[model samples]
Target: MTRTTVTARPAEPSVVARLSALDRWLAVWILLAMALGLGLGRAVPGLNDVLAKVEIGGISLPIAVGLLIMMYPVLAKVRYDRLDAVTSDKKLLVSSLVINWLVGPAVMFALAWLFLPDLPEYRTGLIIVGLARCIAMVIIWNDLACGDREAAAVLVALNSVFQVLAFGLLGWFYLDLLPGRLGLGDGQHLDVPMAKIALNVVVFLGIPLIAGFLTRRIGERRMGRDAYEAKFLPRIGPWALHGLLFTIVVLFALQGKTITSQPLDVARIALPLLVYFALMWFGTFALGKVIGLAYDRTATLAFTAAGNNFELAIAVAIATFGVTSGQALSGVVGPLIEVPVLVGLVYVSLAWRRKFAVRGRA
Candidate 1:
């Protein structure tokens, strides 16, 4: 008894402590990138015009490249063989579909009208943002938050399908039919061609998805699952963040003047977006927990529901309305608000995970 020795359990690392340097300072880096982009756009006279000219099938080439880079690594990390498990979860699938397709757009519609009643152009643009579900960048956010990769991939693919089929119809309903029925506007119709939406889905989601699938298949075949996951994934992981930063820089640079010049308008546009993101993220997360989803799938559901396809929204805005239009400006203001907000949500998701773990142990 006198010689008895006791071992104390080591304390778990805090969430912030566990993060890599890059992930830890994501907000600071994003803010810096935004500042740099804005400064460059303001300082360099012809930069926006130059950047604007580089387009592939009506999408900005630089932005497209950045998205592809950002998407590939996370997509590659998915265990494609296990996607069947994700698909078979009808509750998760149905819940995501309802939240994304039905509730999400409805909430944005109410918020846009509530917040920006006087500004029809901004209102319409926000409605358009609502219609475009997250397909590309939500994956990055999901990965960062340690959500189920396969579930995200499935949900993204599902949204992409709905995007091609329903985006135009939803656009008409929100922009044309609903407003007219409600006597909100002068019955301005927004015709978002299905072909354009289809093309975007192909380019943005399809290409990278195929690339990621093939990369995983080939890497696993060549290197075995252990090596592929342990060795190969680490090398490519950082590029996702790199691509995110690069996209932000280019995006802010393109809209720097507009963003800087129209501070009041930006603030106005930002308010509804802030409200919408908070509602969707927290509400969906709560819903997920209520439905008995584990933290991983719950996090996946929340992120996919919360994030918007700003890429498509911006492209649709610019293509339908002039690049200089309020619609396009509203679209530009989207990612500006979304980036930091969602990044903050990533930490929130992590904290919630820790809390749940502690409760389980108790």
Candidate 2:
């Protein structure tokens, strides 16, 4: 009898390692977009005007289309069949909802009020941003943090659905009614057009969600699941990143004059936003710890809770206000601040996982 020795193969790189060049250098791309936008806005005379002219119902047609492109690929990756897991782990789902929908909004409102009381329009803009739950970028954050992609997808889908249903009502309640009741803003009417809000939701979230589902279903049915995942999905994935970069370029280009003109004013919005991201992230992280959630899920909750759906917020701001309005400027600043902060949190999550995560949990 001959004895054969079986040697183990080297472990392969992670699924995240397979991310496109755009995803890997997202921050750099954002910075490049900002620089390009500012230069174009300063150099070119009428480009912004031309882009703004392509509008419908207060939403810039070009920007709106760009955002939809950005969102569809992310939604297509969601495994809707695994949605039952969200209900099975009721604690995770409930805690995420409370933190994202309840505590998250309250904290942003307070910070925005405390910091920008004099600037009512910008304050209202920040409040609108707070109400938006992250439905797209959190997937990238979750992937980076080595969290459960499937669960993150479930949460993202849930957040998108909730945003469509609740964003208008919540905007009215918090920004208008509660602020009025509390004597926060001067007796100015904060008209949150329900129709615009709903339209933005439909265009950005609902359409993408349905399109993603259909694409995935049809692709898998024709090509089979293995080929669909390996070939088709990866090819289309880069388009989302491309859309994101292009959208950022358009947004900053539209508001470049405003941003470059009042650097200090724009800088002020960052104060409350920075504070909000840190506080909400750590607060949610603590909650996950208290509930004994595994590190992956905890990371998921943290990113989901802390991340803002800046695309929706930006669209709402531009649609409700004008393209270059202070409200729109506030929304544009969100991604500028959010990218670095969330990236830092990704490092923090990774470090904490290494130090404290239970054996075998990560």
Candidate 3:
């Protein structure tokens, strides 16, 4: 009867709620950035020319810088020392290889052919996009979706290696050999120089990866893991988003005139891309769940499989087909579509995360 008053524990705030204001309204900011870039490109004369003047292996230097800045902080956050566990997961490694190498390319090739049968350049461009896989921006997407950081790092590094070895061969197979076999070739062949692909991987993935690894090693050595993660990381985390937004603005501004002028063509290219992203993301996510992956690793797999290396795709298209070609245009249209779609997927992943938590409790 001297019964006690009991206090119930407070429920934790949801994942979305825990995000900082900048992180919370990411989709809105992305849209605004896209609009701003388009407006700048349309309103300002010679802006694209100015941005194009600085180049690193056919990629715009500003865009390259933005990518490095965008990727560095996220890579730095990864616990590199923990990657052995990720590597030991044979299921993850094998599944990723099959989906990325086999299913992803075949699906995009089919979609490109199905959607843009009349537009061969764009179709080829889409195939190139598919073969390049995701090495750069995928880390950001996976992190935002609350994925396993170490797993993402391992998978991304694995992708970079495969990209170097397989990109040219796969490009030849899809753009030349397979098309010929299917009687779909129009006598046009794509030759992606292996050296060019290797250079891109080295600059885009290697430089930042080395920088990030060194940063973490030195920071931890000096500050200890807790301080390095808790204090130092917080200071640099926002730059990742800043770099992403800046890159989006630059990309859109560069392509804004072409995008605005050729609405019909952009729409044509967009349809297949939309279908590709949705199918790849949802399909891989479902595959991960069926195979009994944790929510974090599942998200990593889904994002890695879904995102493309737009920089590599665009560079290869431009270097091979000229900047004014339809192939290049298709390449430019990639991130324009990918950014918004992946942002939506991030929300979807978070909602799924909530369900996972509920099921765990139940």
Predicted structure with the largest lDDT when compared to the true one: 1
Model 3 earns a TM-score of: 0.95
Candidate 3: 10-residue stretch with minimal lDDT: 1-10
Q: How many residue pairs clash in each candidate?
A: 0, 0, 0
lDDT tens digits by residue: candidate 3, 274-304 = 9999999999999988887777888899999
- lDDT (10s digit) by residue, model 1, range 59-110: 8899999999999999999999988888888888999999999999999999
Deviating ranges (above 4 Å) for candidate 1? 1-12, 359-362
lDDT of 2 by residue, 51-78 (tens): 7788876667777777778777766776
Model 2 lDDT, full chain set: 0.76
Higher-ranked by TM-score: 2 or 3? 3
Can you give the TM-score per candidate against the true fold? 0.95, 0.84, 0.95
What TM-score would you give candidate 1 relative to the actual structure?
0.95
Q: What's the true lDDT of residue 71 in model 3?
A: 94
Q: How much is the lDDT of residue 142 in candidate 3? A: 95
In model 2, the runs with Cα more than 4 Å from the true position are 1-21, 144-146, 180-187, 315-325, 350-358
The alpha-carbon lDDT assigned to residue 241 of candidate 1 equals 98
Weakest 10 consecutive residues of candidate 2 by summed lDDT: 1-10
lDDT for position 190 in model 1: 76
True lDDT of residue 6, candidate 2 = 12
